[model samples]
Target: MRLSIISTHKRIQKGDIGEFEKLFRNLYSPLCHYAFRFIKDMDSAEDIVQDLFYNYWKNREKLEITTSLKSYLYQAVRNKCIKTINHQQVKEKYNNVLRLQGQDYDDYSSSNIETEELNQIIESTIDELPDRCKEIFVLSRYEGMKYHEIAQRLSISVKTVEANMGKALKMFRLNLKGYYQISANQ
Candidate 1:
């Protein structure tokens, strides 16, 4: 039985749909439960698990699993949960800022103009960053990757990740501060 399962997995890895469904069926529920532990939300957990499987299938040509298949699935799900949590944190922060500012402006047109200006400034600042620094910053901030994970993915050291991130933040703060000051004066 174990040999047959291993053969099936290898076949799926080679793009065999019949074997892929068999392997997916065997692993789906367990992967969902694994994701639920990290996310604490059943529907989101299931979605994450489904996405992981889809990505795995899409990237099967480059897939390399040294450990058990279950371990690989769990790690993918964990990373996805981390990304989801980080996105929620950013949204919550934005909401809090809006709430404290009390969006009761009588001139909606002015407010919309200001919002567009701020967005453009932010986008321009991001575009002005050094290539590697911008990549690291986006991966860490937007993708919610930890320093070690970023380092591993980029084949760089953790110290390099930290240094680059610090530079990125400093540049953003300087640019964004100027943008806000100009907006306030207008």
Candidate 2:
């Protein structure tokens, strides 16, 4: 499965299936190992490598390799692993904050419990809101979407998003005020 550096580049550029298969066979395991160094999960590492190869193949005609193909593959896997880890971290942090704010736990009477409870109260309150207000609130708060982006996604005007969000907030304040004070004391 050996290919000269120049031949590999030319074969890939020419969309040669044989060379591509040879390249995949040669590179796949090593790239997965490289990804595992960062992510420490075999499945995720394999997925990242597979996606890298798929994208590589998909963009073969337009792809440029200033470095060796091996180097490019390694760099791509490294980047993908980093991105995956970062996204996971952001999600965990967001969940932690949400739980803390929502009163979602027990046993320790710690912030976690308060967050769990608060979360339930908030969800119920949001569910009780009018349909449009609930949608707008979820989009803005839970989805972390900007008002304008929400409007664009829902095919509404920004002003409508603003008005709905305002209504949602007022409803939340009225409904969750007692829960908020109780959680504050905990």
Best-performing candidate as measured by TM-score: 2
Alpha-carbon runs more than 4 Å astray in model 2: 1-5, 103-186
Instruction: Give the per-residue lDDT digits (tens) of candidate 2, residues 5-123.
Output: 58897888898998889898988898888899999999999999899988998998888788777777788888889899999898777668768877433433475567788888888
Q: What is the lDDT of candidate 2?
A: 0.85
lDDT of 1 by residue, 113-150 (tens): 87898888778878988999999999998899999999
User: After aligning candidate 2 to the native by TM-score, how far in Å is the CA of 72 from where it should be?
Assistant: 0.7
TM-score of each: 0.51, 0.54
Q: Which sections of candidate 1 miss by over 4 Å?
A: 1-9, 103-186
